[model samples]
Target: MNCTSLQELGVDSNGIGGKIPPIIGNLSSTNLSKLYLNDNEITGTIPHAIGNLPSLTDLCLDNNMLEGPIPLEIFQPGWLTQLVLANNQINGEIPKSIGLAQHLSIMDISYNGLQGTIPETLSNLTKLGYLVLDHNQLSGTIPPGLSCSMILDLSYNKLTGQIPDGVAGLSSLQIYLNLSNNLLEGPIPLEFGNMDKIQALDLSANKLSAAIPAQIKGCAEVEYVNLSRNFLQGALPSSIGALPTSLHVLDVSFNRLTGMIPQSLQASPVLQFANFSYNNFTGEVSSEGAFANLTDDSFLGNPDLCGSILGLAPCSGKHGHFLYIAIIVVVAIAAGLLAMVCVVDHDLMKTRLRLTAPSIQLSHFPTVQGNATGKKESDEHPRISYRQLVDATDGFSEVNLIGKGGYGHVYRGVLHGGTVIAIKVLHQDHAGEVIAGSFERECRVLRSIRHRNLIRVITTCSTPDFKAVVLPFMPNGSLDSLIHGPPCGGKPEGPRQLDLDLLLGIASNVAEGMAYLHHHAPVKVVHCDLKPSNVLLDGDMTAIVSDFGISKLVITGARDPEVGEASTSVCNSITRLLQGSVGYIAPEYGLGGRPSTQGDVYSFGVMLLEMISGKRPTDVISEEGHGLHDWAKKRCLQHDVDAVAERWLPRDPPSVLPFGPPRCEMEVIVVMVMELLELGVACSQLVPSMRPTMDDMAHEIACLRDGTWRKYRATGLKAIDQTKSKKY
Candidate 1:
């Protein structure tokens, strides 16, 4: 513990026995990061000591007999992901405050004595995928919108009332769903038919009645199903057998079901087990295909049944084989017609979009042309699939996610060939073009412009149900993290403190990117949004401005791209969510002025001031006014520049001081901080005409980075101060 960083402590599974406690001394640290004792027989209450590890991300106490109420402190960590307290004797109702763990993707508290209704606040966990609270005393109807989960096991509970329909339609319910042995009643929701990827579904031993839903044939990937021990009556829908060739196991025993066994089940290629016992069914059951090896145990109690199988009375030709053939023919024809309609509708949609498509001419980078199959053709970066992204990011797992934006979430991924990329995946819940438009617009902007300081696209993965933009993963994350650390949980990447020289360099890089967009690119563009979170730092700490989902594209007939006005109104931007970050947004935008290059300059100025002041533009210094501008102006006049910056400064002395030679105590201050603050004030003038151009600002920062401006600091400072004195 003296020299090494204590990252993890694991003494799992019988390493400690009859335990009243595990050693608590090793848990504490000066720079302690992770401490989790998983899978051990550590007895007594769920430890209050676990509350000590704020950095703990995954706490697995699985298969233990820990007995007591789950402490309120368990869900306090903002970054906690996997919480496994399964197979324990833990009692007490789950705290309503469990919803505070927003990043939680997996929560397993099964096989316990907990009571009370499931907290509806679980819907707030957008990233939650696997939730298991089975074998509890919990009652009440299932809380809905858990459609975000791929696995939901709430079996062996006192859950009552009709099932909620909010969970059935989404593709995320692809793995396994179990809600058996409950007091659930009423017909299965019609939305269950949309579970296209589910391989296993279990809803046994319930009070459910009424007819089996026929729309369930759409479960093209179902392999195992159990619908036993219910009060369900009426004919089993033909869709049960039509549940794709993937069907391998079926159990619908112990119900009041009446009907001939579906012939589709007889022809199932992979079906290994079938149980239709204790029902009023009176049809000839075929012993062909998957049912060939089954014994009479599966059909025992059905006295009226007659089939070709071993222990049942043989049926005469009066049952009519042609009837089954006719039913199969009708089902086949209907499926074919449905697929045809889907293809036609898809083509019609493509036709409409193509008619409105803008002609793109990407001069520097390769142009990606969308083909009829919905795949884009490009050679620069390989085309990846939804599955590849799933594997790369561990099924878009919460742990790999680097940042979350309004429209999308970004995850760090390593491709098969070892190329590290940031996968910017749009949230799928948003209907229509809200998700699609963001993907298209960002690609449109990234393709048209190329700059050292601007982020580049590394191909894209797009399908009807999914879309993601691939870009190089920055080892150092966004500038927002660098300046202010994370909003919660931990410190920023790399050094905890940033020197003024590094800040100056970052500001210069941003200006260069913005200047190129406004002046040098083929299409004159307005970066409608520019802020620190959108500004990422790469491996060498080079700043890159990104996220152009709402950028204004100003294409015109002029041969010189920079000289022409926007052919379309700047307000016709793609994303309707937001123009830019509040407080950083230009004053003109709020007053209904058209977007222009001056807006970018104003944003860059605000960012520059934020870096120098170490305070966000949103921080209100006094009742009179808010923002970093007002705060810095007051600080400059009162001369407390070092005091504000010294809070974030490291132990090292200032390395890039502006004044080169020894001077008086007053002159010892870094003049660059003051000049940059003045520059921020100048460019953020309320009057758009008064703001300096990005070109001038870029040049000014570059001189500061190169230390060439130090010779003329006196004149430069005087000019900036005069510019700031105007009626802003």
Candidate 2:
């Protein structure tokens, strides 16, 4: 093993389930350039003899059961380019000697038990691209020397003091800078604006004070910024709207910011997510362009901010000029008429005039246009009418009926302009108030939620007698139609079977959409009813989450036992009445638990299992007397991937000549199916805490379509077995 001829060695994810052998460092092969031992079950402290490999350029031993402090001697390699020991129990401070590796470019030691402050010596590694030290117990002020990295993530640490001024001068920082959830205090430095190349910056959950420096507009390339949960005060710089067009997310909530929200934010085309809640902002909230989609939740806790957002009062000065004239005319005419009536017949004429005046006043009410009450061109939506919807849907004809649900029936329609749409008309037979409430709820939810994988609401028509929401028609139809439609439905826009590619793609898209709803949206939304039929597919086979009629907004820190509990009891009752589909509901919900984001995760898990096993949750209960998770877990526990695939696909694995070249594609299929089934089983775990988050699910499913998993499959089932017991 000490031979100098060795150049590279890899034994990754090979089911090596014992302590790492001391002899691993016996490979004194001076010519070795790369050493990969990741994703295995190797344990014990790293041997110091690894420093003998003078020519090593990459050293990866991550995602294992390794414990104890990393050996300091490993940094002796002058040519090392990558060093990853993340997700281990390694303790002790990162050695200052790490700076000696002139070629080091990527270093990830996150998710560890490491302690102590980051070494200032790291600044000597000029080529570093990624520096991740999150989820550690390290404390102390960040060293000013480490300012040139591209991706700097020091979140979830106990670091205090102001951010080092040198960080602002990092011209090479093009990825992200995250220092959130720390005890750092003092004003944000104006120097941050000089980091023009950075994309994302997060300084939330800190003790930082003072106004956000107006110079932040100079961070021209930033797309996302989160300074929430801080002590920031004063008006937001109006120049905020002058930020780069790439700006997508800006959250300054939970602060003491006063005065008006910057108008520039309303005009930003790419600014999709903005949370100004829990602030002291005053004056009218803008409702144009990006603001048109925002709901009252975005401005909650700001009592002084008035706007057209639901629940907020309209500003006194809004339409003041027009209303003033109208009021004066009505008052003068009424006074003159009353005097004449009093003179003509006294009490008799007065009683008769009162009855007629009420009717006349109602007939003179003005028609208000636009989604929001504002004088901005960008707030305009196609002014749709109830009569137009009736005409387009052919008088609600049964022939055009596309689908029906608990709240409404959907009909296919073609408008006068030759645009095709799906009209969701509420069931009028239900109590008019209930129907109206559902419509308003949908409007509020849809207004604030925006994601490519979520359905887009085109326009809405509302009148006393009728109400309907128009959406773009999805020609590819719902996932339910693709999976369980009539046999003669013909080929779909994409694949028919839930193949590895299509299954992973659809699963990834759904996870992304759910993640956005649960975390990234302007306001958190929990889609209480997530199921196959609710997931529609466009022509490109992209999955989009539809039907927010029963969604609930999650108010941060609010003590509500049920969805919408912060609101009236009627709202909570409505949520309970529509608590998701039968088989897809989480176990807790059956026991009177509240509908929550976790419940949605459980439902997605069931849907994932259904996609893989082709068995509904109800079918499992009726036939096997348990949920789908039990059946899948039973097969998984028996190490019977073949049985699960056979029951679902029911086809033999592709056969090739004996001792011939291994079929790489076939390997990927088998490995992916087994892994996916395992993931489904994990997600549908009886304990909600045991279930993986939507973000985690998305990452793992995405791995199935990525090259790393493909290569892992080529290595055989030993690799998949090694990862099964690992954390989600």
Candidate 3:
């Protein structure tokens, strides 16, 4: 019993490459607290008798190819704290009995093929500091009793349910709480708001629901908060306005919520990256102070937002009513002149339109091309003939009509040799001088850009009486169809019912495309109108940013005041022009006569959140006093947002029951949803500059997917191992 300590036993030196000796327990001594028989090619299970060592404190059997469950005898005692059985092929769960070790502190069973739920008994270790069970096959809820306060990372696991309320209240949680890409649910606990000592909190890609708690506003000491891809709702709490000025990053995209953005958030001077896109919000936007310096891409997708940011239209109604009346009179006079010209040349105009109608079945022609000739353009650009477009569209046949917009009707057509294309014809009644200028400007911008995300302009045709722009056909249709229409109806079946993965993929791709236009394109392009309808999906579900009618292509190195003034004036006119669809139009466009990229970012954020939550941003506004973005944001702050899941998930018996026979892992799915909500919250931030660039958005989504997939695979492996071990 008083045997001396066992010297370092190098198993690899003995050439013992086969199975571990079962009788090796004889080496155990009362004073043998440290056993290091690692770095060997040894195989087979550890001996049970080794557990009889009452003095054992450190047993590191790492870097070996050992297989089978850990010896039950080793866990029976309660003294061993530093058990490092890592880097091995060991199987089975961390036994619940191991929690009996009241003295255990550093238990790292990482890099092993271990399976099963984490033992709740481990919570009894009051002295535990670093508890890392990452990269394992652990499935089930995080034990609420886990006492470690510093760093408790159960990330990259199949754990489900909300982070237990008790766990969020842990006293040692000062550094971070990384529960990204898990099956966790429920709103982030408000108790976490009191953990002001914590630095980073990442609960992204989970099924957590409700709004980010206002309590967190009290955590002024926090630096980073990521709640992306969740079911969170509501406007960001005004309390967030109280965050430490040192806060650097915040993301809450892809959720259901809405409201007028708080001015306090927009004024935050320290925010570098923030996103609140794809949600429902409506209000006038101003880019003074911290917001003015940001790019237009930051505020894409919000139709009801407007400001003076670069790459965006000027706010509408900025000019007095006299100016509006003057413009209207000018347009009326121009219309009267055009009408007289039509009357004089009626026969010729009719004949020309008829001749070209066959090529553009979906278009009415006269609206899009009629004014192109009178306008100035670079002579090098090719001019398409209206007759060819008419011939392709077969005189705007009903069958060829794909969609209708306030500006014009979109038509599908085939050219002479079978070249399939889309034709966008402007409305004839709006073909006055002002409207014609907008048409020409759109065509000019579309012609110069060539990006996979941007809708390509194949050609354009203009005449005294007709106008049209030809584009390549989009087989997968528009994002609007998927987000707003019934999936089962229509030729393309509208938009497919998307799971969390698919939603994240589409949103990320759209963001990437937008980011390219705003930041990477040779000429900075502001996609002034980035609604769901403007996002087209191709055969493989690849998204292409479309609708350049409101797009602005800024020339590089051009500081001409005339250019700036003209662009600003045109943008201001367009904002007040009532051109965009009613609900999707930015608020400032209706009142302020300004359009900024921040407005677009807000719209895009709304679209993103709407897609993930399966709610209409407009519906949230009209039916619900609050919009979807605000609702989701507020719910995230609460702990009861999971109730919204009932609306989206199948309500059948098995689906509703928590632990039914046909359980479909709905809880896990909900966690993924919450992750998405967090993304939406980020995109919908009041401060446009707080939003992440589309490139960053895409990368975050990819990271979530990778983490989720790994956890899923690990869980499946654990189940297989458990069944096999039971049979033995």
Candidate 4:
């Protein structure tokens, strides 16, 4: 307590435990200008007495286990400039007296348990530049007068009411202003267009309504704008598509926005990614500039949209022209009848003018309902009737049947309107309630979770006697048929050889999809029946995971029966045996272990190993006594990417990957495959607890992808992206 002359102290990341000592308060060290105690395990409430230090300025206690409300006395010191207390257990409302430290340039208290409305006094700090209060339990509207000059983030909170005009109209935000994942309502402010210097703007996952303002094009430097998962309506502004040349990413998925996608987006020289999924967008998708290599992932859930893009039906000009002509002819005939009636009733109307009035109707006009939640499914999806399915599938004839499973049959169908879909029809002869229950569960999972590498639902039909799920027809088909060939006694689709690069890409996509199911989705999920068949390839050979038949939601797992004799036999014989994916089932399940995300990882690992080796896990299981896990562990020779490259190809390559140095490229491919095999072995270890989570698996796959993509560039090999379109 007598250390009055201490000028500086730093104890960051030292595994320090226990409480913030109470003695720290009595240190009236007037000379102490810097104090750092962040990245510790210290617990207990912050001591109010510490504020007695008259000259104490920099204090950092973030990334600790500190609890209770922020002490009111800490703001008494006018010399304090930076305060960091993020990633802690701190609670209670931010004290209104925070404004007392007017000299504070940075204040971060994010990722805490803090609650209550943000104090309006924040605006008083004219010098404040960066303010972060994200990942908290804060509620109430954002303070009307925030003064952060560079960055202001209040995302992932319970904020309510409309965003203040002053906040949106601020032109000084140079970095970004993120108010995403909140309850902000009303139209996006037109004043937001005035922030010409801001680089990024994110307002996704909110309840904001009304049309996007055309004025947003004024943001001359903005590169990213995310307005997805809102209630915005009307066509996208052409000006947004025509944003400044710096704009790269624009997301407007999961809204009610309608009409044609602006052609200006396709012409953007810098735009790399644009998401328009799950909206009411119509007309043809452009195939130029940024849209040149786009996949079906960008346009899912918009059935009316025709395009040259993969997975979308090609627009038929002859049929469309005749249809338009027919509609115009019908309207003309209706107008003629109405005119004749008006002329005949002119005299009658004058005689009865005092008693009644004539009402004109535009009865020939076509109208469609908006695709918002809570509306009938027919309104959002194309209205496909029961007879329509039968007609499309020709009464579920053998010629239309694409595949069959224990629980259902899959039929390839094309609707009269020229949309191709795969229909999974549940067997009516199966256990009635059990079949219905599984169908409902699959539908629930499909409808709630969405990702770029996950199969998207078209629409589902349910009836007392018949239940079916409709999904987009994957052009390249399932990974099982691609690598291992289709099941026995079926028409051979011919040999399909996947290169190491393509296989790695498919593995990465599957991992990403599993990560979404396990951790990132609105509700955590476990794809209990993950296997090669469940992983399908889209038109670009991009992987799309499908079939959530035996998936489990972690929150609702307790309600389901545990894996045992009662359900184990049924599960193995049905979803597993029917698909010959018993080799993909985690060994823990055989011992009655419950379904888990780790189990999904194990299955994915088995699939990954299979992709690299081009052999099934069950090929010689009985004779060999071990599956691909042991095989990979023994065959894979772990070595550094650079070391392997040097040993196999000593000559420096003139060019990088996807280009010259053919022998070096092949040898480098072998090294990457070995690395992936190592990952597979780790994931498929016998102990379920030893398996890496899907999140970790996804990250590792991405790292491997990037590492392989750039490794060749290190050996004096010039790397040039042929997709020369500039991107940030």
The 0-to-1 C-alpha lDDT of every candidate, in the order given, reads 0.70, 0.73, 0.64, 0.73
lDDT tens digits, residue span 285-351, model 4: 8677789868879998997888778666568876865665577689799999999997888767667
Q: Give the TM-score of candidate 3.
A: 0.45
Which regions of candidate 4 are displaced past 4 Å? 317-728
Question: Local error of candidate 2 at 367, Å?
Answer: 55
lDDT, candidate 1, equals 0.70
Sort the predicted structures by lDDT, highest score first.
4, 2, 1, 3
Return the clash pairs for model 2, or none. none
What value of lDDT does candidate 2 attain over all alpha carbons?
Answer: 0.73
Residue 150 shift from truth in candidate 2, angstroms? 2.3
In candidate 4, list every pair of residues with a backbone clash.
Answer: none
Which candidate would rank higher by lDDT, 1 or 2?
2
TM-scores of the candidates in the order shown: 0.45, 0.47, 0.45, 0.46
Candidate 3 per-residue lDDT over residues 106-199, each given as its tens digit? 5656557778888788777876644656556778888887776444666666788778777787645654567777788888887786676565
Q: Which residue pairs in candidate 1 collide?
A: none
Off by over 4 Å in 1: 1-379, 558-581, 621-624, 634-650, 653-669, 708-728
Q: How does candidate 3 score on lDDT?
A: 0.64
Worst 10-residue stretch by lDDT in candidate 1? Answer: 573-582
